[model samples]
Target chain A: MRYVLFLYAAIAFVVLAAGSIILPDWAMFLFAMALAKGLVCLGIVAMMRGGVVSFGQGLYYCIGAYTATLAANMWGLSDIFLLTLLSSAVCLIVGVIFGPMLATYRGIFFAMLTLALSMVLYGTLSKMSVLGGSDGLNIAPPTFLGWAPEGRDLQTALYIYVVAIVVIAGTLMRIYFDSEQGLITLATRDNELRVEYLGASVRKVMAYNYIFAAVLGGLGGTIAVLALGHVDPEFAFWTTSGEFVFVAILAGYMSVPAVFVAAIILEVVRSFSNLYFPNTWQLSLGIFLLIVIVTLPNGLGSLLSRRKGGKT
Target chain B: MSAGVLEVRDVQKTFGAVTAAKDISVSVPKGAIYSLIGSNGAGKTTFVNMVTGYIKPDSGEINFGSRNIAGLAPRLITRLGIHRSFQIAQLCNELTVEENMLLAGAIHHDERPSFFRHAHSAAARERAMATLERFHIAEHRNRLIPELSGGVKKLLDIAMAMAGETQVMLLDEPTSGVAADEKFPIMDLVIEALRAEGVTVIFVEHDMDIVTRYSERVLAFYDGQIIADDTPDEVLLDEKVQRYVTGGPA
Candidate 1:
């Protein structure tokens, strides 16, 4: 059954990629950006499963983006793979440094602490002229192992690259969600005391989850910066973090694939609402969230499960 | 105290002006079913908390098998062969009973705790199922936590702790929320299971019948002090216990 689902996902991804070749350039760009944002939602889902709702994942996101952009500008390192590795490594270090503080909080305290940290980053980024300040830095177009795309081919390459990365991430994430650490992390959300009593270190587990979330956030930001060709202070803003949270809630922590679906849905909704309502996109999102909260408290992921009352 | 597997000496804790525990000392022998009985606010739970390393005493020594573990983290204490079941039944409300059991089994038995290994590895699943079967909760293994009865939840709570290398098990109000008629059966299964594993069991219970029926040794607490400590019959018959605890000699 699992293999069949994987095969189905592969076929769907192939279809999506094939379809993207014929689609308009703007649509392809939007799709890539959505997939990039989806990566951030994946991290949010992981943290939420561990009883944490970070309001500052954008901190790591911004860090990842800046690290990639800065590394390119300073060291002339523009390889996609190298940038991904560097971003993840930098975020892991940041996560470890912040792990102790994150471990000391839970619930709203954790949420607020995370928000404060992100705001600090935003404030710093906005003031640093070397980083282009509020204007931020523009990232050089990335090459795949030395093969740089030219003009129209850039969109095609990026679109395919994102699809492949999202697929790999989604597949790996599914396995992770089924792994021992994932189960324990999810269990901690319900009862930290019981988890501790069972012989697992709650603080250690939270730290691990925090780092994992940070790595994901960093990866997502790296992808976003590469796709958009720009990295900015606004990427670390509380509202940006709130947007990730919004997608996570829309996606639910039930399954890994939900994150991608939620991100795409969010982007599509935002684009349509921005075009149609102009001034009421936020209002539209708020209403959508209110409805999801009321009708499907577990988020859209619950819709995939046939088992009633079985929490994902 | 030489023969005791778990020992507490001169433990004292005070929250503000209220003394939750004062000069509390007790020794629990290996493979013994020890019960602590007291009224509400009598520091029974506080004693359990201190022993389990949930709360640190201002001054005391808690030695589990020769190691002084007074201020250790709860996980370290638990890893040192002491496990606890909460009074309110601390469990993963979003997970199934078997999942909870498997989590306990994996944490307690798997030292490396691999991220690659599936949580329900064959060994873990079998162990979880066996533990559930031992507690007569096999029927509810697949059920979500909130679906189980209070008696079943209480039993599962204790049963989950059995997954660990439990040399000493502390149970706080094991039968508190359970139905009166189902209490003894749950306690009987719990005691039998622990005895089979040679676990030294220390439980804080308010029910006199449970204390008398299950405990080999009973410690009666009054005003944050052990007013009586003896065999069940002797502790139950003490005048201090009679007046303050049992409301008169039975």
Candidate 2:
């Protein structure tokens, strides 16, 4: 069953990569950015499955972008792969340090505490002048093993790279969802007491999950900075985190591929609305969310899953 | 006191003005079937909670094989070979019976509980299947938990607990939601299953029939203390126990 999903993903990404050559620069850039945001949404889905909805996911997102920017500027580290790895390393370290506090909380307390943490980052970043303050940092063009693609080539390479990363990460996360550690999230959400009695620490399970979410969110931020060639304090803003949560709700936590699909659809809708409706993009997004909630309560993936005759 | 496998040394707990447990003490011998009986608000559940590490006594000792586990975390105590089921059949409602059982088996894995290892390994699958069959729920393995009846859920709850290496099995009202006719059969099967594995059974039960029939010893609780600890016949016939716990003629 997982093999089929992987095969479908490989085929889909291959088609997308091939299509990137013919696709307009703007279209490719937009899609790549959407996939980057999908990584953040995927992390949110992981936390959501564990019965936690972090409204402050932007905290790690900003940390990744800022870390990549700082490393590139201070040390001349411009490898895209290294930047991505650095984002994960930084977020993981932060997660381990803060996870104990966050994992000890649940429900609204968990959500609000996450939001508060992200807001603290936002405040700190906005006030710090050396780190670019409110205007944020400009990233140097990233090199791929000493080969830096220029202009259109850069866009094309980035599009393909982002797609490949999302596909690989999605597949790995899907395997995790099927594994024991993954199923324990459902148990943790269902009955924390029962999971404890079963010889698993609920807080530790949640703490590890929080760290995973942080790493994924940080990875997304790194990719986003690479795509845009800039980073800002706004990345840690509450509304930015809210947008990721919005996409997670639109995607549903049931399937891994659903996260990417949701992110792409959201980006398409937002861009198209910004082009057509001008001032009503938020309104359009709100309407889209309402429709999804009222019609497909489990999100668009449930619709696709039902059509394929698979479990939702 | 040291002779028993599980011993409680004057455990005490208080919630503000109300005292849930106060200087309570008891010892459970190895492989012994003991029933705890009391009226509502009699501190029976609180006692069970403390024994299982869900509640920490204010000032007392909980010795499981000479290890003082009074303030230990519930999972640590669980790892110490003590397992329990909830009174309300707490389960992963969205998952299939097989998945839930496999989760229990996976946690018991000796690989230091890693995500890198396959959760549904061949060994874990074999153990889950074997246990499911033993509990007579193999046919419902693929079925989601919400589809199962109350009795089956209760049975599966206990079955999931037994998936690990348990020395002491704490069942909180195992037959509460079960039908009257199915209650005895469920208890009989559960007690038999646990005893077959040489597990010491300590269950909280409100039903007199289940207590008098299945348990060799009974602990009667009243006003946050153990009023009687003796054979079922003697405890049930005790005048104070009958008046306070069983609501007999004062």
Predicted structure with the largest DockQ when compared to the true one: 1
- lDDT tens per residue, model 2, A1-312: 566867987997898799687899989988888889899889889988788989999999999999999999999999998999998999999999998889989999999999999999999999999999999999988988789989998988888888888888888887787678887886788778878888898888889889888998998999999999999999999999998998898888888778888888989999999999999999999999999999878776676553223332
* Model 2 chain A weakest 10-residue run by lDDT: A303-312
TM-score of each: 0.95, 0.95
Q: Residue-wise lDDT of candidate 2 within B1-250, one digit each (tens)?
A: 1268899999999999999898999999999989999999899889889988889899999999989999898889989998898899988877789888988887877655667556767777888999888888889988887789888899899999998789999899999988899898888889999999989989999998889999989999988999999999999999989899998832
lDDT of each: 0.87, 0.88
Which runs of model 1 end up more than 4 angstroms from their true locations? A1-9, A306-310
Residue-level lDDT tens digits of model 1 in A2-62: 5765896798689778956697888888888888888888988888888889999999999
lDDT of 1 at A123: 99
Stretch of 10 with least lDDT, candidate 1 chain B: B108-117
- Return the interface RMSD of model 1: 1.0
- Relative to the real complex, the DockQ score for model 2 comes to 0.60
What's the CA error at residue B17 for candidate 1, in Å? 2.0
State residue A99's C-alpha deviation in candidate 2, in Å. Answer: 1.7
